[model samples]
Target: MFEPEKQLVGEWVLDVRPEEVRVLVSGFQSWSEAELRPLTDLQAVPMMKWRHEQGHDPAFLPSGEAGVWRSHTLLALVRPDGSGWVGCAVDAAHTFTHWEARVDGQQVRVTCTSEGPAVEVAWQDTADVIGTLETLSAQLGRNMNAITPTPLRVWCSWYSYYRDVTLENMLDNARLARQHSLPFDVFQLDDGFQADLGDWFEPSSHFGGHASELPAQLDALGFTPGIWLAPFLASPTSKLFRDHSDWMLRGEDGQPLPVGNNWGGPYYTLDTTHPEVLNWLRELSATVRGWGYTYLKLDFLYGAALPGVRHDPSIGRAQAYRNAMQALRDGAPDAFILACGAPLAGSIGLVDAMRTGPDVAPYWDEESRRVWLGDATGPSARNALHTALSRWYQHSWYQPDPDVAIVRRELSLLNHHERGSIAGMLDIIGGLRASSDPISMLDEEGLALLHRCLQISTPDRPTTLAQSFGGAVTHFSRGTFNLTNQSVTNLPAHAYLEQRL
Candidate 1:
């Protein structure tokens, strides 16, 4: 319980337990009555769908104006001046926890809600924002029993070939790897191979109607075969959605709940709580693993947890998401599973690796951010770096995949310095090293840069803070390099790593 120096304005019944909690904090002064003034105020972390979200912005200072902020399972009010700060987080097991803060006039009201876990809230007082976060993340990791796997260097076909990837393109990259002796551990076929989002069993026309043979072909080239899928999503035109409408999560009106707009139109979420859906998920995982692909990248997983009337009404959103994950794990026990666009706390112990940020584009463009009206969760180099740098503390729970390292200049708009900064930033963070560049088209320098980025040694658990000194410029010191000029999609984007001896 938080004992503030100021009198409590309003309160709600807090059902406290080891795994969940729900409380309403209405109108209060600062967490502490200390004399030290705050340099900047308020920090909130997003729950999931980090793309195009505003809660995790470093330059976010909701001091005077009325504003609302939301975090998935944690919220913090930090005073970076070494004064006093308060951090609140909940243990999300069978529940999904979220914190929403509303600033009205001079009063601030924060409500912490848990969909279903046994209520447990952790309150801490500290000025060290990063240290407090690290401690909390570690505690959550222990509670979830998360696994940290050795990161693998991967070559993906997403940004390189996009949805137009063909059998020749895969083979070309594979042959280039063999010829150049690239030490890539996995060769992954991204979204293009699948016939549709929900129909994962059949290949699209791109592979001449056969993707199973490519795994063996990739294995022959000395790389483990990998694949990508949005296991919980079903496109409107998908056979799964057409044949089994009951498997889809529904709204109060009994219509399929629209998860998001992608793959030509709106897609829907599968109700993992549905027994048949869980069985299908398990069979899907088994089929993929049986194809000899050992690495799996499950993406757009937030759809599974979207609010809807589930088959099992007792299960909350986070638990529903975990149910699908458990089925996949049961079916493919030995395969490495990478969770992307997933609820952070819901996926802690289930996945071997997790994408810690948005997709990385080939250029430093913010058109998506502009189109989304300043949603920082879009595809861009700056957005990727900013979010990854902010969430790097999560490396304790699983291998942090900071998307792909785009280094090839052939199809990119990133300048030399910008590319170098991105490579340097990822190298310092030292998470999963992956690239989507066509190695066959790379010049010697580009190849060398790709090689340099892949030659990364995972750092010990991070304790250093990534400080944003205004203008979206963040600094995090690791090894001999310090990331200094990274932006959070607010300013003209550029990244530079300054050496600190």
Candidate 2:
């Protein structure tokens, strides 16, 4: 409920309608606008703004247009007469162009009944005015909290290549984990299980002809068996691709889309919108479940949300992902879902856990640069700290995976201080991942660091707080903090005390 004349300066309310959502940015009058400016700007707004600004370029060209910059925010009102008002605004230029929204007293809500993409309603409330804009686009998803009674746990994915891991190796590792008494509930088998990624069902020769037994072995060891599967992607040589070439995403020229270089040569993105594809995925999930696997890590999920495709854009990217997630849930109702490379907001209320950072490494260097850098002048742990801080609320509401905690390993090319810094940050944030293969060539000190990290628990909020370059780290009363080093080279780190502020 809202009072027409009441000033909404410190708090705001958001309500969604069937066609559009009304975001009332109250809490400010003319005199208080100055104070609110810092919170609303992208560079200064902290967590919320940091998440919103992802994938956006300062200079962007909108779809179906060129040369001119796309409107930072576009608003339009369509009436039954087929003629209505259109508005646009550029926050960078401090200009509001073609702005028009029906204002009811001090409240304004924009309605879009058009044939374009789903509509987005954005507003910045100031002391004097409530800046509002609505764009015809997709509706985003919200991050949902994890199931109750499940205490936050940390575990790691097994990159076999990194440590020559095998089923026997995993069993040995599990034995070590049990002996070390590390707090980890799941152990993920990453990237080396299938004969090849393209052939999802075929087990690699190294699996000893009994890949299915790995889960039970883990179960006997008191750990859950988690396997990595990219549901939307298929290798170019995959049998599914051979059987249904048309099932993959197509370019404007109707050619099969390239899967990109990160995974392999070229693969296809499954059209999740197609009923057959959904059915296939459901069956695949059922098969995986039949093998006793209880957890599934869905990676490279962003590719499934591309616009202007066969999907129903009216439902928005978030909803499309929700649908896919629902399909996965229907197939494996009891399995835990770990979503990665997807928008955090869009995954709200859907996934059981999410990867908040790219990948993290044991040290800072060129090989590790993709996930995190080691340079003090760069973002390093500093950026990761901000990310962890901003997403702290998720721990109370949902499971937050600050990526993997790479414990010190002999094979790992990181130094002692670097390992200490990484360990300290993981301890503070209380993330849910750890990787220390038994056969991997790690020393006692490295294993000790990992054992210490696994003992840390997730916090409701971070303790030591610092913010820069759209990132942050919040330390907790438990002497742990969540750190995010977003820059390619710079890493940030913060210390935490075991007492509440």
Can you tell me which runs of candidate 2 are displaced by over 4 Å? Answer: 1-149, 152-164, 311-316, 365-386, 437-442, 460-471, 474-501
TM-score of 2: 0.65
What would you estimate as the lDDT of candidate 1?
A: 0.65
- Candidate 1 lDDT over 264-299, as tens digits, reads 767888999999999999999899899998999988
Q: Determine which window of 10 residues in candidate 2 has minimal summed lDDT.
A: 27-36
lDDT of 2 at 354: 69
Q: Each prediction's Cα RMSD?
A: 8.0, 12.4
- Residues 1-501 of candidate 2: C-alpha lDDT, one tens digit per residue: 101111111212223121221111110100000010111122211122111112221012121211111222333232222223333221201111112133333333343221123333343432211111122111112213334235344344353353234676667767777776766787777766676544678877776555577888889888888877778777777787788777775555666665443443555677667778778778777778888888887776755544324533244433555567667778888887777765444455556776655455544533242233221111233333434444444343246666655554554655554566556556554546555444245567766766776675644433222222222323345444323334222333333333435
Local distance difference test, per candidate? Answer: 0.65, 0.46
